[model samples]
Target: MTTFQKVNRYKKIIQDYINKHPEKNSDDVLKHLLLRHIPLNKDSEQSLQALSKFRTTINPFFRELVKTLKNPEKNIIEVLDIYLKANPIKKNDDFFALLVAYFNSFEDLYTNKDLQNNTALYQQVIVPLHLYRERMEKDKVDLACELLERRPVLKYEDRDLNAINFMSPDYRRISSEYYENQRIKDSVRKDHRLACEMIRTMAIPKKELGRVITDLLKKIDSDDSLVYLIFETLGSLPIPKDQQSIVVTKLLEKVQNSKNRSDSEAAVKALIKIPIPKQQGEQVAGILLENIYSGTYDFRSLVPKLASIEGQLERVVTHAIETASKSKPSSRIFDNSPEYTTHRLACESLKILAGLPILTESLRERAVDVFLILAGYSDQQMYRPALEAFREMTIPESRHEKVVNKLLENVDSKDGIYCSYSCQALAVPTVFEGYHEKIINKLMEKIRDPNGKNIIYFCVALASMPLLEHQHDEVSNRLFELVDTKNSDDFGYTVQQAFRALLKMADSNEEYEKVAAKILEKLDSGDYRVKCSVCNVLRGAVLPERFHVRVVTKLLELIDGKDYTVMNNVCETLGKFPIPTSLVEQVVSKLLPCVDITSGHHSIDKCACEALGNISIPEHQHEVVFNKLYDRIDTFKGSFPQSVKPDACEAIGKINFNALQCPVIFYKLFMRVMNPDNVFETLNRDNMILNTLSALYNKMTPTERINIVARLESMQDDVASKQPNRLPFLLSVIQKCQSINAFSAGLLSHLPAEKAEDVRSGMVR
Candidate 1:
């Protein structure tokens, strides 16, 4: 008979026996047919394929069929080759069972000699053999060793090694075999797989590893891949103290001499991980500083490493300041010169100094003085960095007066940029509190000048200062007068700054009421930027109880505006209010429609979805709000903008779902994740849903979590049958639920002894 006809005939016979012996399961019936009519030699590529149509029946028969074979090892290889060729996804239980039977029948499959050089068979059986080694009675460690000796490189070494480790207690043997394979291959050509595996192994001796690195560095110029892999291996593994100088010298040579910028950067990254010898620290810092001067590397990456070297922080800082002082400004209007590079390096250096872990008291004072001097430089770029570094430092309380006097002097400078940054600097802690009167009076003088440059920054500095009750009205009114009401576009930024200042000074409901009145007056000024800014302030500010009603009403009024920006900001503001019971319906009713796909604007829809997350939805309004978000997930049809679904998931988790509603909410979020079309299975989207699931699971009663887990388990079969690709997502949800319950019930510490090490490693990873 033809292969197709013969397969069909076998299928007919199996089905007939199954029908006759309905009392017996399919596995039992398949076993009966295999021993009685279908001989062991009857197996074929087409026959296996036809029998595979009967799930779970082939596994039992494979177990029994292997026992009857004369040359089981050879026959099993044939079966595996045909089966693997047919089903490459390789998740079938029957295929796994066949592998188990194959290993059980052989004392050493590699001992067959015919199979040792069978690369195809070796490649296919390597992963499965390691995986099922625990089930076999024979010690397969030797077989695994032989397999690795022949096939030492794998693309997926992390998974492959993890499987190999399961077979043998001495992983050092497996690791060393792979390392030696790479060493031998390195003479002919570089094998990155072997190199990467060596980096992961903890068994390679320090002297041997150093020799490998030294050899690789000799050929670093000829092969670019060796440069990256060798450095990565060095960075990941700790260098022996005796070999540190040898490696550091070579890397420094690369950093100083190599023309390739990426090579230099990689060398610097590896150097950062190595513990610099105390004697070489200064030399390392000096080389890095030279690169920093040329602007060849990011100073942020280099400076911290420079500071980390013993006693080199001050040298780096001083060099930066001295270099900056010598750079003269270009007389040309648009100049790109070494002068600009020097000034930028200086500014970054100042910021980096403040960020260093240990700045001695003397060095701190010097840093403060140098920053003040650079603040007065004609270069406008130095202003913010100067103040930014000044802000980050904790000026000794004793020096607060001296620092404030210097800053106040700059506040009066004719350089508007310098004066504004000085004002910003004055808002720092002890200085702001100790000298508020002087600082505010100086700023008040600047704000009164209507045409003053950088007035918005001055206003921002003023807003950041806390106000006394007596000074609130005068300072706020002065800022408000600076707003150009008739044509806000001319002063839109300044207007936003003024409104923000008023919002900051509002410490009470009465204070916020005044700010609200100013906001109400500008809401119709035809400038959406102003409207958006005011809404943003309310969105971020903690609205007092007295202002909630008035603000919620105004926000609700703006919710229907045609401008999406205004509507987006308005929805975001309304979300922050603790909507009174009387206004919950109005707020929910307005927001529900905006979260729909028909809204035509993603920003508005996204904001509306997020707004639903924060609203105090009365029990009566939960169903409607949920239904709107439910329609927004696009579980089967990715019709909504991808941005809207995660927000919807967040909003669903935030809802106060009743007993009947929790499961419904979880099912939607879980299944939405399972359906790939929802956000295309983006990691970000999956994480958002996973976080929402975890949070929601935590909120449930222990009993509710149990019921939810049970319900989730019941859907696994449907997921396997219909959407098998998403089995991981389903499994993740179940594991996450169980993990949350374990932690909440204080059972994490009580896990069985065998799993303790695995759990700790998982947590560390």
Candidate 2:
């Protein structure tokens, strides 16, 4: 078949499937798009290239695709790898348009250990990330709006990505209704009613939603289901920071008196997103706790709602303690499903308060009781958070002496994480408080407890120990022993820490060499902690410059280490040492690979990449790292983590000017970051990007020199109105503009006064 024929054939097949099952198509298109590279054909190539056409064609499916991508085709995700290899851009968000949404769809929220090393997932995640560069060229809004309107036909989930979302009939009805009900629709009350309809129609699950769109429209005008929709769509709306609390107050009043369970539940869930302005949140929490505890209302129905206060942390804490005191404490506190979530809510509330404030004596005491009781929790889901909260609260303080001692006394009786929990908590300041000897002696007493909690306990304890607090102690001696095994995760962490402390206090060769050997023994440890400790010990050691070679070797072991932060971290530590050639090569190679990593292709991996840049030696690694970094910086489409990209950009500019004497790379990387697409998407405010621009301009091309005047002029409005993060980048651009014009005359024998002042009005420097 001809290329167009094949494309048309696939498009028809996809559209046919979408016609049969519309809802399923949303996820399919997203899954298809996130491929490491999208394969655009003769048919869809133009559509991908024309972003406005793509968005309009895809808009109807936007909501559905979001839902599908959210749930994902976990089993069929490998399919994305196939598409990514094709390098197709079906959509664009900002400058880097085309299937960028698909790239995002493939990302898991935090690091996904389950599929971390999976090569197929890697292909699905990175290639399009690389492909995004082509679509990110400079463009005007008219073109953007035009891209949003285009219809590109593509196969996703055996269906046409566009066909499934082509509910023209719904749009017609909505448009007609919009015109007929324009006044009402424009009104706030009707706006609320419309939100209710959207929730009942678009947001709520079909089974739970019960009524159809027409019925929902009538009901939402009077129902509470709209509350959930409002909160869910909160991100899309232009909500003022101050107006949130007031709206929340209204929602609470509505939920408080609502007769419908659905209405009440929706209202409570909506409350989760509202920022409670601390004081207002506390007031609401107080009312909630009192109402639940005073026996005025059955706590059973309100637990989930109360749990929603997790967002308003302080209020949640105050209310939780008050509720516990007001009501009788027993295992049966949560009597039903809704109340069950309430107990979990209280647990969550306590979870947030840990390490925040131990001010409330009674609250801490009760919270400790809650954690202990929950240690045996039947639900593993709740147990994890509760356990985490327990560990957080038990940091090296004796604030809960009675609780810690009580927990420690019974540590041997417990098994699994329960015992681990107690031992780890007891290792804190509370146990060792001015009684270091007593705490050290007690460490071996609970070694028998399973779940390895005691092991974790020692790890944390050793890390938190004061550097000069213990001098040449036996505890340090025991750490030396554990450092030898280096295989156990927790044990390695503990030994590595002890090494960090000893290296600082070690005054003589005897002490330095003693810890160095222990550090070396674990140099082969695959665990990042071991490698890091090995790196740290070698950092300040008086080891001969010859040791710098081995130190570089040890740091290399962590270069591509699974832990994202390990490579950059090792380099950072190594940078501190006075070193030579081998060290320079090793550091350069380690940093270059990070520039290639596309984890920051999404919002998540940016931090790791940024850290890589921060530790980089911009002066030396210039040629080796600059070009590839410039490419990555120029190509990145969406908002990246603030830390990584900026550092990368700054390092690139610095190395370009100081190392390579290439000033042009500066203008290219600067413009790419300054003009990122999706102006409103949350990730764009990477302060690091701006910091890099500012640093670059400050050092080499300050505004007074006015080198890249046009770009600065273009971004002037954005610089003024850009999110808080872009402020620094703008400042640099402006500073450079002003400085260039103010000082541009210095670069030449003959300078024009008119040209100089005009430049001064345009930039910051």
Candidate 3:
């Protein structure tokens, strides 16, 4: 008979038996057919066609085979052995796909204790895998990765080693025995690549794998891509610290010699991933800094990476400051000298370093001196960088007075730009401890001088400080004179600064009344900037309770004007009022539409949320406000602007669940906290969720708390394994409960042993 006819005849016989024994399951049918010694007719096109048709009729049988292989109690080795021996699936057979599926499911099998202990069974599985590996065309590399990942510690028996040798295309040395053959010298590159892929995919114990990886690193030549891949794999292994330092040093050398930008970037990246010893920290920092100055590559991207090293921060900070301090003005006016260019680069670097979260006392002192000199320089371009560096520095308490005095001295100088920069710097509240009065007097003296063309600078300086109650009257009157007498349009920046300062001094009812009247007068100004300034000043004024009605009336009128900036400012001002219950509906009705608009204007939405949160504080209004915020959160899940969601979360957190008289509120928030799909991953959102849970925890009854805690305990394993931070965050929420309960005990017991003990000790205290 022909091959197709022969296979069809077999199918007919199996179909007849299945029909006769209809009560038998698919497994029984598969075993019966396998026991009959059905021929696969290996590699025949006709047999392949027939088998494809036959597999469709026996689909259930293949599924049953998969289930058996996955069952932990079954001897997987024996099952695979029987199936491979009986069926003898060829590369072209229809059963090959099913077998591949079976291989893919072996991840869980690797975790089985029986498979780990049975060395003989390991031999049985590897025999067929080696055959399959050799036959695989498209998925050969993938199958290799899977095999390594599944059995990373698979013993290298002679048969297994022979299989690896046979699979390599470059293995050309002929010998009577596989182990006796010498590998071709030209195959070293291919061998190294294969070794890296093996090491990367396998979970070989670090002690055994580390040496292999290090030796591979040594054998590779100047092939950047190969070196990069090997370095990445090395990063994953727990190599000894001393060995890691050696790898870091070699990578640094590679970075120095690499002319290819991509290669250099990759080398630097790998170097940073391995922690450098404290003694070697400066060398790494110096090399990276030198690379940055050479301009061969975009080393600016490496600033954050460099800053992450433990001991590199001080050195980087010192180098940048020293470079910037050496800057001097060009001898020829307006000519950009080489020194000027170098100084500019240094100052830019200093700004980046200052922005880093790590700032030592010595570095801060150095930064202060460099910035002060830069600010005092004649070049206007240097002022902004200097001011930025100054703002970022954590000035020591002992140096605060000296720094403030130096800035004040610059403010008294004839250089208008320098004076303004100094004034702005002194505006930081902590800079003027006892010197507030002295600085404010100096600014007022400058503002009072009719010759003071820099009155705008002095106005901004005064506005930046926190005005005390006793000095309010004088500061306010002088600021008012500047805003009214001076044409605000001519110096709009100055007018805004002066008006903002005047409103800040309005602490009492009389002062607020006076400031409100002045702002109301300016609200009619033709200049849009003046109107914007008036709206901004109104935001800061503490209107009296009686004046709230009038203030709200004026703000509502402005809200009708439809200028987004003015309306946004108005919404923020309206939220600050402790409105009477009679006005809640009017206030909420006006604000809700603004919040509901999804036009991507986050500021307006943010202000509306804040206003709604403020008005929703009344006991009777909690449920209505809660539903509104909840619906907004639901409507815009992932597409919402960053600020809107956190604002909504915070607003929802402010609701009084007890006052709402709805027990479901607690459950709803609890579910929202636990739903991983719904949670935003940002730190702000996570913190807001934690805050919301803390709020709900305080209100939850013991039964409700237990339910929540039980859910947390159930999810603890998945969460702890995926995101370790979440466990501590959830524990923090539980800690906020009014009192501990049995739920707490159950939750604690689910934590890892050390963490659970720490939590137990904390609870006792």
Best candidate, lDDT: 1
Instruction: State in Å the error of residue 660, model 2.
Output: 12
Models 1 onward score TM values of: 0.57, 0.47, 0.50
lDDT for 94 (candidate 1):
35
> Order the candidates by lDDT, highest first — what do you get?
1, 3, 2
Better of 1 and 3 by TM-score: 1
Report, for every candidate in turn, its global Cα lDDT versus the true structure.
0.63, 0.46, 0.59
| All candidates in order of TM-score, best leading | 1, 3, 2
> Candidate 3 residues 82-167, lDDT tens each?
55555555544434433332332222223233343444433434344434424432132343233222311212222334455655
Steric clash pairs (candidate 1): none
Tens digit of per-residue lDDT, candidate 1, span 337-399: 666876677777767776565876776676776666666666666656767777777665656
- Model 2, 1-765: lDDT tens digits are 432233223333333434344334334543433221222432233334322234433433333434445654543434344333344323322212323333322232112332344455454434454333223211222222232223323222222233434476565545544445544323434434333323322222223222222332233344343444543443222334556665566656745776765555555555544455555665566556643433334344454445455454445556665433222224554455544555555555556664455335555666666665555554543454545665676433434454555555545443445555555555555434665555555554433334444443454454444434442354455455555654554654566555765565556777766765666667777666666666665655566454557666765666666665465456556546655664565566665665555453332234334433444354555555666665655555555533444555655544435511433455555555556552322223444544555455544422222223333434444553444334434544554444433343353214354544443333322
The TM-score, computed over Cα atoms with residue i paired to residue i, of candidate 1 is 0.57
